[model samples]
Target chain A: MKQLKTRTEQILATMPILAWVAFAAYVIETGAVLYSYTISFVDPEAAKDVYRGLNLYRLSKINFWYYTQAISLIAGLAVSKAVVAWLVIRALTKFRLENPFTMDMVVRLEKISYAAFGTWVLAMVSNGHLAWMMKETGELQGNWISGEFIFIIALVYVMSQIFRRGVEIQTEHELTV
Target chain B: MPITVNLDVMMAKRKMSLSELSEKVDLTLANLSILKTGKAKAIRFSTLEAICRVLECQPGDLLEYDDGNKK
Candidate 1:
């Protein structure tokens, strides 16, 4: 049990780094997509060929509403992911293996859960909008719903509850003797 | 709390210092201080027994029930 706990802690300690890397990748991908759209606007004839071949030419002419929706979706998801990463780093930086049940841990877990839930909501809405846009453009490539986001949100919520219980038990134990 | 710890009174009656009581009871001074200051949520039977034995007193000597509403 001790070995397993240590291993788990080690993994948790590395999670902030992984989350930040993922967030960075998401930002870069969004930037690349936006750049491609910008190129299509600046040089329609040349970029049309590229967009057409890629079957995303329709996206180049997307209206302001759709464009803003897509941008907001990307920005919201990125911000939430970054927030989770930052919270994890701040919360677990001084974690003690001997006494893992703390109010600080509980608060951090709660915040992470809220951020993950927000990300899941944004992902769900964005997937719906994207799917609709694709269908409108006659490029229905199947739904883009991210089950991973929902799963992560649920997992974080459960972890928050677990930490809450841990805090209660720790309090009781402290008062026992 | 309705139940209060009178450990300080007993310690004083026994002419014992906090450190001396802590050594005799095999508990840390901080913990003993918690008991002395009535800040402890609960006390273990073994700890109570050790303290009672070391101080040469009964449990009743170290605990009191305070009814605030009583005249």
Candidate 2:
């Protein structure tokens, strides 16, 4: 429908900054947690003891801290992707570029496409790494593979197509309209 | 052949000024001028419909083929 008025566009333009702020807050929170409670600040041995105590269920628990770090990394990356997308859309509107097919849109979409592909690759490889860690603790027998991983792979394919189609639409719109 | 605008005829029949037509159609006068002078590369069907409704005319009344003006 794209009946965006001036006021709406202004608000939409601010959304990416808001997302960045929120993502930064999570990063800061994680940093704060690492600094305050874990005696790992002054004594590596003490930190190891604390982690070992919590990871007492290392045999039963899933790949512990590695999983948490991976999730946070993926989340931060998702936020960055959103920020980039919002910026490109805002810049296109601001410059009054013809459509998505111009050099500008191509570059923007390319960045998104590459990011999506790279993230999928990272996730897949990290899943392998996680599988290895899980095997060390023998947690791979029951839930070695997450169905969500398959979903993520599928999402990568779908999004790549979507990004490609958006480019095509922009190109056609520019040429014909 | 090129499309020719019949803005003068519509304006005369309605006794409407460009400003009046702009207000009636809720479009900027500059945009209306662009359409009137055939300077615009494209026009939305909605805009054409609005113009037809406000002027009580058909698309043929506002636009015509001018093959003789091919220069």
Candidate 3:
């Protein structure tokens, strides 16, 4: 018998495209961070107005070790976040609403949780560096503070646990006679 | 996992094929195969009743508790 999909599954079907869009945004963000870092060194004159008039190029020169370390941490966090976004896309691609609970989906969810955890760690490190820089350099942390990654990690970890149980239940149900 | 299925023995005694039993019980052949191979995690009472009715056997005849079956 064919079952009509609920509104949630219908939305789930559309979520993959949204996930891809998010992935693209993350890629763009990583590229922007790397570009800003490289431009600060390659063209000191141009770096003054790159980040919406932040003048991070001149900021780096104020104290090279502190500013550069904070910048590197920011870049690392961006790259790790992009990796997490890519993992989310992969998990969404493997998910099927018709058969939502499968070993493959469970494995993918676990992988996403792991990646998210790694990203969260990187976020914590970046946040610490940025916080210290804010104190010394008096520069605002702005959006560079990534404390939000902890929430993302918790969400994905809970989802993976639920999916693991779902896989077990589905297996038991299929084997029932 | 120690609960063992004796469906094959019961079917042989009743001179019934897996397909015949599946048809009489209105269950899919794959489901019947799963039960016969002892891979089934559970059996519904209605399903056991239907299978017993088709094979002319008791639930005890179709299933057995085996101590040696650790898995």
Candidate 4:
């Protein structure tokens, strides 16, 4: 990725670095969520710590099991997002500037798109779970799901399609005299 | 493909080895193999000209179009 063919490609190499940073951020966020969840269980009073603008730990006072369930759902969503971020990092690392269009790249891009779609689905499920939990215990707080992933999924899916076509065109070009 | 390369047929008729044709045409053996095997997606006018010149064949002799689902 550090190859210096042009200024544009030099800038392109920075994309992988950004993706790695994003991946690290997601990993750290996942760790923080898990740490908070664990701390909340150890000290029920610490459940008062607000996370994602939601006083989810307060639910522990109403119903301990339900609070655990809510926290678990949130953790699951976090892990799914981290997985998606890791997939993005993997795709970025595998990407090549020289002879970039290949079947391998198409497959990796497709995998990343699929992973993003899965994350979106998990986000929807977690959003529904949070709503249901709030209704069951009469606690409506901040939003757990931002409508961000729809655009992400669409963009990545479209990128994968473009890469697939690129692979086809590159193959045709290589085979042509 | 409906359109196909017939480089091997003309090569055989001219009694030229792939390497000999490649040397005369100044094309790589691999490219000549691709054209001969009909694996090439397209041929350039320059390459077709070189092959035709070496094989003493017309473009029609080096390429053919078969209607229907022959491929």
Which numbered prediction scores highest in DockQ against the true structure? Answer: 3
Off by over 4 Å in 3: A1-6, A50-53, A145-149, B69-71
Chain A TM-score per candidate? 0.70, 0.45, 0.83, 0.83
**Model 3 iRMS:** 0.5
Residues forming the 10-long window of minimal summed lDDT in candidate 1 chain B: B33-42
- Residues B1-71 of candidate 4 have per-residue lDDT tens digits of 88878887887898989999989999899988998898999899999899888888899998898877656
iRMSD computed for candidate 1: 1.5
Q: Give me the runs in candidate 1 sitting further than 4 Å from their true place.
A: A1-16, A33-56, A62-64, A134-148
Q: Give the range where candidate 1 chain A is weakest over 10 consecutive residues by summed lDDT.
A: A46-55
lDDT of 4 by residue, A1-177 (tens): 334468767667787788777777767766766677788767765666536455666578888888777767766776777777778777777777777787887888888888777777877887887788778988645445577868977887788888889989988898988
Chain B TM for prediction 4: 0.91
DockQ of 3: 0.82
Assign candidate 4 its CAPRI class. medium
Quality of candidate 2's docking, in CAPRI categories? incorrect
Q: Mark the 10 consecutive residues where model 4 chain A has the least summed lDDT.
A: A45-54
- Computed on C-alphas against the true complex, the DockQ of each candidate is 0.57, 0.06, 0.82, 0.78
How high is the CA lDDT of each candidate model? 0.71, 0.57, 0.77, 0.78
Per-residue alpha-carbon lDDT of model 2 for A38-90, expressed as tens digits? Answer: 44435433333222133223332344465345334444444444544554454
Output the TM-score of candidate 2. 0.37
